[model samples]
Target: MKLLLYITLPTILFAFYSCKKGEVAEVKQYSKLKVTVTNQYKQPVSGFTISLKTGSRSISKVSESDIYTASYEAGGYTLTINKTGFIDFTEKIQLNADELKEMQIVLKAGEAYLKLNSDSILRLPSSSLSSIVKIQSNTKWITKDTSDWIEISKAEAFGDDEFYVQTKANLSDSIRSSTIKILAGDHEQQVVITQYPPIRIKKTIGIPGNVMTQTPSSIKIEFNQPVILNNLQSLYYYCISGTPLQPVVDSNILSFNYSCGELGGEYPFSISVKNTIGDTFAETINVGFYLQQLHFKGNIVTHFVNDKDNSFWLLMENPDILYKIDMRSLKIIKEYPLFTNARMITVNPYNDKIYIGYSGVAALYILNPDFTYKTIPIKLDSTRLKYNQYEELTPELYPVNLVFTKSGIGLLSLSYNGDVGNSRFWFIDAAHGHKTWYTNAEEMEWYPYTMDVNYDQSKIIFTNYSLQYFTVFDSKTMAFNKVYSKNTWNQGDITVASRKDANVYFQQVYYQSVVNIETGSNTNATLDALDAARFDFDYGQKNKIVGFRSWNGYVEVLDFTNSQTPIAYHYYRFFNSITNTLDGKYIITAAENGNGDSWVSQFPGEWFREEATQSSGNTLLKIKQYPSLIRKSQWR
Candidate 1:
């Protein structure tokens, strides 16, 4: 009975040596049959078992025990076995009764390789859009990533492909959708699912230009825009590519196309606004030059000069520096600092000399390069004038506004007697330091800011807050002549009658009053009371008080001819139809003084902005992005 029971032993005793050009294994006690199973690389497979069977009985399963024996009971049969991911074994072998087969089983059929994405993928959120997709399966398993097949994931039938492999899902394909099959031997497969990102369409247009130079423009689109405008650059710009093509300047109006190359093209332009649906609407216009303006709701001190060139007005900035700005250019020509407490700057354009009063040092010097400049030490030495009271022409005690006449230049030096003392004025000779008389020196017990003298250079208006008083004095004599009771109406908010001109002016609390300097009266001065309100008097424009609209309704352009019944030339609010910006075009809010403020800057194109601050060690923020008007041609 030739019962040939076969046994295949897959041993990992010694890793199979790589055969050279032609190398054969050395036969040992039992004929060697190297056996191993790996997917792609030559790695030992554990879960997969190889076996040799004879008819209904398997000879033995491979093991590391040298071999696996088969029981030869009746007739003999051939043996065969294979691994799940390996090639089938086909060989004939003779088996002894209860014999342990010691042979190697070299199983090398390669790995079933496939490719897939390890991580899960997700579609981006959709915009205002619609999307659709068709997925085709590469394998018939229709296997899901997880148990819940609906919430599909990226669990692919991972295997490197050796043959053609692609699963593109189209509306029409003749691949029977998908199919699954069980191969006779081990195999590798893959699966692919198609997905589309949520669909959306977005578009935008832009206008780029130099604020000073001509404008430049551009246009781009989102794939699904209604229409697109390309290469929209001209002397100006007007282009939009949003869905529905809606355009707007600030949000007030709509936008449209207004390209022009006709006769005389539009040089000046205003801001143009458009609706979201590509429709043109309103626009703000700045027709002329220098449209930018900054409205400073602060204080401005204007000093008068008496000279050859007659520099009529000088704006006093502070106590130390004097900035001579040309009104025409609004530019600071020279900014010189006075070495002393310069409370007053009286320039004599005729002499081309600038006189500065130093109250602290008790000195008066001419700032002009060629004037007789001198400093007077006021602690009198000889004269029996004694350290008497401080009044007009006392000493360089409290310098404020200076006055120069045939009697030399008088330094309005601010003096302090006590907490309530009004500052006194001093007088100095033009050539040498000559101290003179003191008028109303007794009233300087309180500190007064402006000690104004009348045209006669005699009467003085002293303002020490709650103590508004007036005193009349003789020029050379310095005698206390007449004392006029001063109230908030007379001296506190006082305005001197113009000796240069013929206008009477004064302020009571907040109301500006105009009366005759000779009669000390205004026959027709309106007393207006307001709280947080200010106005600019148009002395040249018919006394038209141009100010905030809510101040007194329209402008009080009154012709006080009757002195009793006041009449209006035209009831008008300055801001009624006013374009708040300097150019009368765009409107912008700026952050200042810990708050956002709105202003009309004077130089339409001037730079008006807050200071710069350091962000990190290097980063900086320019809060002063001066907004301007969008040109009208660019609006469309």
Candidate 2:
């Protein structure tokens, strides 16, 4: 009994020691997790799969209704909720002992949309056929009302589909129109339907002829088929006589006569004529202008001459239109309509691509050969916003001039309406996917009246006339080099850098002077002529500068290389803008009268020579005037 007790006592003590060293097994504590899913409107959502994962352990469950509940061991876990037709909801969760965690999740609905190919549909008066309209939609859509004269193939559709609209032949000669409404939930849009009359004007004569004399001229209107004339009413009769003579109708032909007042003036006439069948035709005609210039339906806004293509491009308003004219043929080669108003333009010398700038937007438009264009919005540094003279920042900066370097980089100048001293420059590298930079906002002050590039294309120079600030940019590096503040005596409204030297020419308010850029000194005394020249250009002839004596009817030629003397040659009319060809063969100027009449004239370069003082140059061609005297020579 003693030996047995000794052996059992050691075994019992060893077992107790092992148990104490092992430590008590940890008690597993769980936490309750509750998740509620809802939509954007706070409505409960169902049929969502919820998953919770921690290390190697994971729990997944499908919610039959809005709420999901589960229990998990205390730890950090990843939570995710997914459903079809809804955005996924994901989060990280922490569970604690004996704790209930509740989560409110909002699931966003998938995108819903509806679209049509066009906003309007036009049909003929004689056809009962249907017109198919393509549509793109992700939600169910339906027509609002049943049309009487129109019948649709389907009243409702889902997803991407098409519908047909059929209309009966119109019995009346008058035109008719209707509006159709398409509805998709909270989205609604309209489509306009119009049917025109069968009758249309076939031709007209003497409609746009000039009233060379005060006498009236006979006008005739011809139609497709025989028609009876009912009445004629004048809409706009500017510079025209009382009323047009009563028209004499013979079959489909109607004749009338109209008289006008002065010469060298434009006559605008508009008339509306009705036939016996209630059909009407309305048209506005420019009876004509005294000067035989190219006529257009839109007003000329700006123009650019492309020497490489031997073409001239014009930007016109009243519905923006771009017209390309062949300089060799003097006829329009092509025309394109624009969706936005573009006031400034330039050509990229490297790619021959066109860059257009707008008036009120911080954007540039790249025009392609196929008449398609892409817009690039410039992100303006709002911190550098320039308030106007009135200290108001409401008006945004717009591009006033756009010039490109030989390397395809575009330099744009921007300013506001008034001379508010808020002007800056933008350097854009379009070839490199539109990489852009800007001038030091603090470095720019007052208005940048003019900008020019040197012959080597290495330097770009511009001036701020108000502050007498002259700035130079390194074109090759696309960086600002320096800016010089000139004295008020040498302050000028226009400045041009010499093509061959470091000399810069300034056409002041009353005189012209030359400044040496390297020495920062005025090299020449002021040459005072009759009236300050409003426009000038580098003559491309051995440092020769030509200035147009505004309202003096003369072109002043000065030789900076020699004694700075101004030689004047008679030019019949005052010039608003002027430029010359690279070979110095031709001089072109666009002029306008106070009466709003404008014309463009070209003169041979030889006519402006010092020996040609008695030579009164003749005009080669005439066109509408251009704007902005500061940018008078963008012909290159």
Which prediction has the highest lDDT against the true structure? 2
TM-score of 2: 0.44
lDDT measured at residue 18 in model 2 versus the true structure, 0 to 100: 69
Give the whole-model CA lDDT for all candidates, comma-separated.
0.34, 0.60
What are the runs in model 1 whose C-alpha is more than 4 Å off? 1-320, 328-333, 348-352, 370-373, 380-398, 406-411, 416-422, 427-434, 439-491, 510-512, 519-521, 529-636
In candidate 2, how many clashes are counted?
1
lDDT tens per residue, model 2, 466-531: 544466767676566544434455455667675556667766555556676677766443445333
Judged by whole-model lDDT over C-alpha atoms, candidate 2 comes out at 0.60
RMSD in Å for model 2: 26.3
Model 2 residue 622 lDDT score: 16
Give candidate 2's error at residue 577 in angstroms.
1.2
TM-score of 1: 0.35
The per-prediction CA RMSD against the true structure, in angstroms, equals: 24.6, 26.3
TM-score of each: 0.35, 0.44
